[model samples]
Each structure stands twice: as structure tokens, then as C-alpha cells.
Target: MGPDTRARATSESPAGREQGQEYDASPYLPRRGGLAALRRASADCRGCPLFQDATQTVFGTGSPTARLFLVGEQPGDQEDRQGEPFVGPAGRLLRRALAEAGLGDEEVYVTNAVKHFKFTTAPRGKRRIHKAPSLREMSACRPWLAAELRLVSPRLVVVLGGTAGKALLGNSFRVGEERGILRPMPSLEEGEGEGGGLLLATVHPSAVLRADDREAAFRGLVADLSVAASALD
Candidate 1:
């Protein structure tokens, strides 16, 4: 095959996503008001194919004036059904860790990098299983996130898991190498100072559930979050 053809066949989009599908969230964002309006408008977001199967648009929740902004990969089964981010098993653990780390939900705003729950069903039970969102979807849904950041204007941003890290820090970002250390937030093309929040990369609370040594993983996640708390001082 020729170079251009091979490039198209073998490679992916700017986010290194295979370009499986495309949906845009911008059209729904422009006329929206602040957080509440955005939340309402997101109900109809057809930004990508993910919304096709998800129960509802799981949007960000918390105080708009929050100092700490936390972003996970996306909604899980419970979250999709509840129409709120971080409201599942992972969310419970996250709340516990945040409390232990000296952060509280009142002072924090939580969201997902991709707002929808992407999943596949198991044959036996027809159970929904979590699936990682592609880079294209992340890219597509980013405008909503951008609007969120603009309105919230948080002091710190904590990116949970590799998906969120990749969505913000680029595809090559590794949470293992960068977790706990504060880095400048990557520009979302929102504005000059819009992405200026101190960023902390860490594993999602779900990681603790999947870890062979749950204690170790939980400790590591808490430790990273503690650093974010420290940034508030």
C-alpha cells in the first residue's frame, strides 16, 4: 500500500484514536448558560455514539466555585443510570479517599473526561461491562469539559486514571511516571489562563478494586490525592 493509504489504514486521529466514529458537543454548548444550563443542555448531547447506548448524559456535579476539580475517564454503569459522575463503587472509594486526604465534596467539583458510559454486554447475563472510550470520543466531548473548566475555574485539577491523563496530557502520558507531581494544566484552547490550574495525575479509585494488592493501590491513590490537597494550602 502507498504511504498515505497505509497511514490512513494503520494510524489514527490526532489523539491516536482509530477514528471509529465522530460526534460533536460544541453545538449544544454555545447557547448554554453556566453550570446548571450546561448540565441541562447536556441531556441532549449526541456528541458521539456513546450517548446512543448510555441511559442518560452523566454530567459533572459539585459546587461551581469549587477549588478542586476531579476528572475521571467516564461514567460507569451506576453513574450512567444515575446521571451523575462518580456515584458508583469507584465514587464511594473516591469520596472516602478525598475525605482522608483532607478534601471534601463541597469544595470539589467532579466530572468525567467522557460523559457517557461506553460498555459491552456479557453473553451469559447480558451484563454491561466498562469499556475504555476512544481518543476521538474524548476529543469530541472535550468542549463540554472546556466549558466546565471555564465556569468552575478551579485552583487544582486531579486527573484520575490513564484515560483522563491521556485526554489532558496527551496520549503518551503515563500516570506511573507523573502521578503526585504537580504539572501545568494542558491548554484546552479555552483561554490563556483558563487551563492554569495545578494538575495532579493519579489512578482512578477503580484501580484499587482491580489491584492484586488493594491496600497498596488505595494507599498510592490517597497519597497522590494528598498532594493535591497540599496544593490548596
Candidate 2:
């Protein structure tokens, strides 16, 4: 990572104030290793309070040479328990969507903006309801995602949902406004120049599952993903 990128990763955000001290995963990142080293190091991360409650840190998974990258908001109930990103119902939906969009499973790398699962317990059952990570939390955990970006260096990044979008593109990102448009990826200082690669934003698969018109929502997701597929051609 370049000095500027490193500086952003270590910088304090609001979550730091809430914790009464600065917090970020940057400190735990391996200064001299690849994805394997990063995954091992992340297991011990105490960068944010979310780790205190999460079962484990879910790191990105795929070959380093994958041409496509997919970033989601964070882990859901099933994903947290499984120690992998996108393994729940939403993940299943995503996999199907990718197939429909003509992107093979082996072509993509999958991960999340935040590695930990943030949630609140249900009052009646032992169920853990999903809670969206605050921007502060997203900022705190960004270095891991940044590192993944540096390593995978995919030709196109499909950002699923607003959280992942904001993590990559900043606060102004909106899925409704940005979905399906291919544009230059912002420089992460490790891969791709200013005009290299492309980023496309879309709603989270969970949102499609939650929609009243499930089929329509799923089709919309497929449509957006097809745009990404076309770009690779």
C-alpha cells in the first residue's frame, strides 16, 4: 500500500471515540505477506468491538488471479457461524445470480467490507438479528478490504449494497442511483491506475429476498450483474 492509502487505513473514525480510543485493523495487517498471511493475522484482530461478539473473522476467499471481485456489506447469521462471507441464503442467491449473469463461480473473489458480524440478540429467542455496521465500523475495518483489493486486483468490482459501496466510493454512494453503471475504480494505490478496472454497485441479495416482489427483485439483481458481465467482454 502507498503511504496515502496506509494513512487512510490507520486514521481514526467515530467508532474510535465510541470505544474511548482509536481502533483500526491496519495494525494487525501483515506488512510482508500474501492473502494467506492476512487471513491468519485477521483471526486475532481486536480492531473493533464487533470482534468481541463475532464468532470469527470472515476473510475474503478466492484465487488471487480472479478477474472479478464481489464486495458485500458484512456477514449474516449463517456466514458468521460458518467463518466465510456470503454463505447464507443471501449468498446462495448471489451465487445463482452470478450464474444467471454468465459469470462462473471460479472467476470471482468474494468478501465483505467488514469482516465481523454485527448484530443484536432477539428478546425472545437466542437468534441474532442483523444490525448494519456503522460507518465508523466500516472505516475501522477498511484496511482488510483494501488489502484484499491490492492482492486480487480484479478487472471489475461488483459492490453489493450501500455499505460496501460507501466503503469503496465514500459516503455519497446510493445503490438506487449507482446500480448497473460501469465506471473507473478509484485508485487504491496497489492495483489499477485511475482509468483501470470498473466498479458497479447494486442492492444486497438480502434486500431482494426481503422484497415483496421477490421475482422482480431477483431479476433486477440479475440485470445489474449482467451489466458487469458485459463489461468483462
Candidate 3:
């Protein structure tokens, strides 16, 4: 691949991950609205072929009245079977940490950039292991994510990782550089859902779960989340 096609890399805690390179979820459909109907309507999503392998499309969870919305990259192994976002091991870590960060899972609406489970089938002695999604994959799933954003219209949106960051902020988003930075939720404002919505970026709890020093990475994750917690203060 050309250098221009290279994955943007970062120096985080995830040991086995191709550090510095945040994978893209999709590229084809960029629309960020009309999900409630589209999800109800389409039996098949031509936007991306990811739906073919996934069990079912996992949509966002929480109340329309929630003040905060947290977005992650995509679903993981356990989440795939559950048909909900953030139900996997990583999600459990997030749930605990987010609570310490000053919010409960119920207080924040949670979702993924892509609603489906995307992984490479591995021959684990007759089983499969999980892998990350590609940029094109993330892009294809963007439309559904956009749809969730419109429906929830959270007052604060926390991007849990790069995929969530790129989907809303653009390709050059760097969590290390921009963590704790909250920007106006332009789309929410434009749609009249909520005013003063803030968008912040942070390391996904999953990233910390994969870290060499899990405790340290989690602490950092919590510190960033503390900023999120303080958004209400």
C-alpha cells in the first residue's frame, strides 16, 4: 500500500494492536441520519457487505433524554452475539470505568460507528478469533452511526476511539492530541435536537484492555473520562 494509504498510528497501550494505525469502519455511505427507518426497512445493506457476516445489526442504547452519548468503534465478540453495543469484555471494562468517570451506563447512550460485527475468521483449531475493522468497513457503516446521532442528539458525545473520532471529526483526529477536548455538536445543533452539545475524544476502554500494563492504561482512560464527568460540573 502507498504511504498515503497507510494507517495513522498512535503510541497507546494496546500491545498486540498495530499501534498508531486506527482502522477505518467504512467509506461508502456517509449519511448520518434516517437510521430508525432504514434499520427497520432494509433486510440487506448494500452500503457495505459487513452485514452479511454479522448476526444482526446492533443499534445504540439509552434514552433520547440522555445528556451524554458515547460512541465506540464497533462491536466485539460478545457484543456480536448480543445484538447491542458495548456488551463485550471491553464494554464491561467501559461500564465500570465510565461509572467511576461520573456517569452510569444508563446515564449515557452508547453505540458504535458500525452496527455489525466485523472480524476475520480464524482457524483456532476450528474456531474464530476477533480482528479489527478496516477504514472502508468503518466508512460503509457511517450512515447508521449518523442515524443514531440524529435520533439521540446528546448534549455531550464522547468518541471512545479513533473510528468514532474519524466518523464525526474527520480522518486526522488524534485522541492523544485531542483527548479531553470538547467541541460543539454541530449536527445536533443543526437538527435542533439539543443545544450546547459537546464532542470529546478518548481511548476506548477496549484499547486499555489490550494494553501491556492494563492498570496504567485504564487509569489514563479514567482520567480522560473524568473530564467527561466534569462536563456536568
Candidate 4:
């Protein structure tokens, strides 16, 4: 599909989609092997239309055996350019928060619910801004995440935003109402497979960057993540 068609498709409201609709990612999954193989296979994935204009598939990066798996929304402009996740301003903030909460890079495995960067250009054509991934796009890419969760089998899955939370949990999940709490991973349908051991919801680091009080928001994020850190004890 062309850019305009893809944009229009993804711009549809969540309510516009029919109930119980599913997007399949199984065809994009690696036939055999682990994370390395999966990451390589993902680069060529055309599971959704988002890949058409995306710079490249931004796969998960971090320890293969880390006990904590962190899921974010999608790659920002910087990450899209750099071909990695969590390397932009929001990413810097996340790293800082992790440090404050006493968790190092080695302790976490980071990835996004959506592997592709979805964006729209400014009228002036100088800037590209993030566009939230539609539910269909998220669902189309979920199998990769489910595969990661299965491979890593972390003790805790830390959801960093509403997108990631809703993708893993459900549409009814609200980060504001449920942040910082640990919930069991609900069983999935016959084919969907389990995600994480225990799920913890929290605001995305980018939310702090956009907040009125950056300090307070940063601290709150750190506090929420600290709970995940403390869970290790």
C-alpha cells in the first residue's frame, strides 16, 4: 500500500474496528532459532503496512536472559534513524530513571510493542512527529513480542505506556489507574501464548518529557520502576 493508503488505514478510530478482529503475525515469525534469528527475520517483515515507509524494522535490543523485560510504544524519530529503540530523549530519561531506581542496562531487556516507526511530516517538511500505532498495527506485530516474552521468560514484564499495556493486557487497561501495580498474566487464547510472568504498568518515559513538571514526572516514573526493581529482592 502507498503512504496515503497506509495512513488512512491506521488513522481509523479504535471503535471503527469490529469486535474480535485479529491481525496475524505468524507468517513473519522466524521458522526456527532464538532472539538473534528472530531479530534478523523481523527486518524483512511485512506483517503490516507500517513497514512500507519505515526506515527499517527496529527490533528489541538488550540481554537475552535479563529478568526484567521492558516494553515501550514504538521507535521515535531518533530511534528510527538509529535503527534501535529507546535511544531518543525519552530513552535518555528512561535510562536515567533506571539508574535512579538502581537497575542497570544489563538487568533489563528493552523492546517496543510496535517494531516500526509511524509518523507524519510537518507542513514545513522539516520535522517528523510520532503518530500512535493503530490497534490493528499493534495486533499485527504482537506475535513477535509474544515470542520475545516466551524466549526471555522474564520474572516481570514492565509495560511503559498505554500502548504496550493495552497490547499485552487489553483495551480496558488504563495506565493512570493501574500504574505501579503487579498483575498476573492472563491466559491467552489457544494460539496466543503467554507474555510475562507478572505484568506491571507504568507511564511511558516520553510522557515525563512532555509533562508540566519534568522533575516530578521523572520521579514518579522512577518510583514506579523501582517497584519492579524491588521485585527482584
Candidate 5:
């Protein structure tokens, strides 16, 4: 079925939010479709106000059947303009770390907890500064992530930051406390069937970029990812 038709099939009511209600993306999700259908439907999503300022919805990319799924916090300025996740400086670092951890490109799928970029503008120039998405925004955008997890059913998921970890695991997830260990995946919702996969949390590559000890941080990220890679063996 087509994306629009599939989206309509999933929801009986029109897509909108009532006053005083939190924004939700579930109505925009397709009842039955693959990644392509989900991607197309997401383009028209008004699930949250973040869409207003973003250039476009940055959806996950990589083989649908990839065994290793990588989740980041959200798209950055470069990802916002390009409409692709992990193409910026941090992405470069992540690519290197993945290689160091022995994870090939072909085995990995990458996405973010939130599809839109939330930012603040600088006073001097038109430079946009990254702002972390509020927990409400993360909650609003979660249906997409849940759908992806349900479809992919990956053997392993490498969470690249606390935000992605919290979005997938729970608000109580702490990367520092939980990094470098494989654990069972949590269901995004009741009866979602998202369990059974292995999950590993780690510092986002952006953290390595901003770190005082860059070499150490990058090594730590690679080490955490290495644990994920070994689990797929």
C-alpha cells in the first residue's frame, strides 16, 4: 500500500492534537509498511513543533535487514541541511570508531531518537547552535523509533548517547553507568515485540569531539562499540 493510504489505514480519526494535549506521532505512522513507507509518511509529520524549524525529517538509513542498529540522540545542523544522519564531524568520528571496533558499514543501520533538529540561533551570525530535545519531544517522536525497531528486529543495537539510551531504555538510563555491556532490548511499548535484541550504550561521537581528552574519549567509544560487535559473533 502507498504511504498516505497506509497512514490513513492506521488511524480512524484525522491527524491532529487537541488543545492542552501533548504532541504525538502515532497517528502519522503506517499500520503496515516497511522503512520506505515510514520514511515517506514522516516527511509530512506535524507530530511535534520541532518540524517547524527543521529543514526536513532526517530518517534512519542503511539496509533494512542490517543486523546492527545504531541510534544517536538526534540530527545535527549538517544532518538537518542534508536530511541524513551522521554526515557531520561527529559522524566522521563515529565511522572511524566503528571501523576500529570491527563493525563493517554493510552490517550497520543508523538513526536518531528524534527525527528533527532543535536548535538556537546565535546573535552575531546566522549560526544555529544545537539544543538537546526536551524529554517531551523525545517522547513525541518515539513511535517512529518503535516502528523501526519492530521492523528491523536487529540482533544488536548500539545506543550512541544518553538521549538515545533513555529514549530506548528509559529516562533512568545513564550511559556512564551502563556503557560497554550487552543487555536485552526493552519493548518500546507493551506488546511491541521489540525485545530479544542485545543493546549497548556508549558516549556519542559528539561527546568525543567536545572532550578535553579527545584520544581517551574516542578510545572509550570504540571500546564500547567493540563490545557490541563481539556480541554479534
Candidate 6:
């Protein structure tokens, strides 16, 4: 296995985490419409400390008018390097499953719950490990997420893993328990539209790729993606 693959398996912590530090909100966040507005709004989003250690905030990419919206946690190392969300090995898995579900990359907008990459540094090396962002950070970054949701306004929103599900749906949502279930989302806010968007929970692609039981995890992920397809109706 490659060094990256090994790290993917064993390392699961952000490089620099300081929960005590409060993130400052963007005072004059951009209000323009479309993806450009999102880019501008994310520019000064000091909503969390994850932005500090990350190279740059990798925003969501793909078609804005897509019928489906896929939400992940945050950027991985490759994503950080590319300054685009979900462009790594996990992303490839996501793309494959999406295709299998009769969805094209152009048919959905993909993003994350947390906007920035959160990681921890290894004691001996410069490597920054990935860590799950706390609920606090997720909440802090919620505005940006809301903005994206406001624009994309996808008919179906798929929470790709527990993190995305917990942040968008609720904390009690067990991804394992709820995987493949298409549940009507509770009203998020006024701008989120009437009755809110449909929500589905599934395991993150990284989990599938890094698991000891790769086959099981991958199959489970595929099953969840197929559910996403069914949810589109």
C-alpha cells in the first residue's frame, strides 16, 4: 500500500485543534447570488480555527443546479492541495457510486458540513492528520452551509457519513442505523424552502476506503448511494 493509503487507515486526527479559540464571523459576508457569492462568502469565514492550519478552504464544486446535493465532512489532504472538495480517492469512489445510481457528476452539487480542512500534526513529521470537526465548529460554519443550500436548492440532500448527517439532520442520527433510509428533513430555516429538503444518511467514502473490512464497507456505501437515487423521486 502507498504511504497515503497507510495514513488513511491509521491517522484520523486534525493537525492543529484549538477548541478554546473562538472563531470570528465574517462581518460583511458576500451576498451575491450563484457560486461566486459562495466563493466570496467563504473568503473571510473565520467561523472556525480549522481554516488556520489548512492550506485553503476547499469549497464545494460541480453543477449548482443539480437535482441532488451531496454533503461530506471536510477536505482531505488531496482536497486541500487541490482547493476543491472531494477530489481524492474517496471522491473517486463517490463518483463511481453516483454513476451507478444513475446520477452524473454534473447533476449534483457536492460540499461539506465543515468548510475548512481540520488536521493534527504528527509528533515526528510534518504530516497533518485528519480529524472530525467538533459540533461547535460545525455549528459555527453552519451559515456558510446554509448559504450553499440556499443557492443549490437541490431536491434531495445526501449526508455522506455521520458527520454530515449529525450536522444537518440531528445528533441522534446513527449513520449505520439510518443508512439507506430517505427521511423528510425537518424545516431548517425560511430560505431552505417549504417542507425542507429530503435527507439521506450514509457512511463517508473515506471510511469505506480506509476500513479493515473494505468489501463490506464499500458495499454498504453502494447500497446507500442507490438509496440516494431512489430518494430523487
TM-score of each: 0.88, 0.89, 0.76, 0.87, 0.91, 0.84
The sequence of per-residue lDDT tens digits that candidate 2 reaches over residues 1-233 is: 35554334334433333536655778788998899999999987768778767888899998788889999999999999999989899999999999999886547899999999999999998999999998878988999998998888899999999999999988999899999999999975546567358999999999999999999999999999999989988
Residues 83-183 of candidate 4: C-alpha lDDT, one tens digit per residue? 99999999999998988988864478899999999999899966988999998889888889988888888888899999999888878889999999988
User: Which should have the higher TM-score, number 2 or number 4?
Assistant: 2
Instruction: Report lDDT (Cα) of residue 82, candidate 4.
Output: 96
- Number of the top candidate by TM-score? 5
Stretches of candidate 2 above 4 Å error? Answer: 1-19, 189-195
lDDT of 5 by residue, 1-233 (tens): 36575445334323233444676888789878899999998887777777767888999998789899999999999999999999999999999999998885547789999999999999999999999998988998999998988788899988999999999988999999999988888888876655877888999999999999999999999889888878888
* Candidates ranked, most accurate by TM-score first: 5, 2, 1, 4, 6, 3
Report how far residue 64 has shifted in candidate 2, in Å.
1.1
lDDT of 6 by residue, 92-190 (tens): 988887787666543788899887889888899888889998888887776677777878778888888888988787678788898888878655564
Candidate 6 regions exceeding 4 Å error are: 1-28, 190-195
Question: Between which residue pairs do clashes occur in model 4?
Answer: none
Which of candidates 4 and 5 reaches a greater TM-score?
Answer: 5
Candidate 1: tens digits of C-alpha lDDT, residues 1-233: 24564345233332223354455677667575799999998886766666667788899998899989999999999998888888889999999999888886348899999998999999889789999998888988988988898899999999999999988877998988989999887778844543677899999899989999999899998899889988898
RMSD each, Å? 7.6, 6.5, 10.0, 4.9, 4.8, 7.6
Q: All candidates' lDDT scores?
A: 0.84, 0.86, 0.69, 0.84, 0.87, 0.76
How many clashing pairs does model 4 include?
0
Ranking by lDDT: 5, 2, 4, 1, 6, 3
Per-residue lDDT tens digits for candidate 3, residues 1-233, read: 23332221111212114533333332223344354554553333434545656666777777766788889988887887877788878888988888888776447778888777778776566344666766766765665676666676677888998888887776788888988777776452234543447888999888898899999999888888888888866
After TM-score superposition, the amount by which residue 233's alpha carbon in candidate 1 deviates from its true location, in angstroms, is 1.0
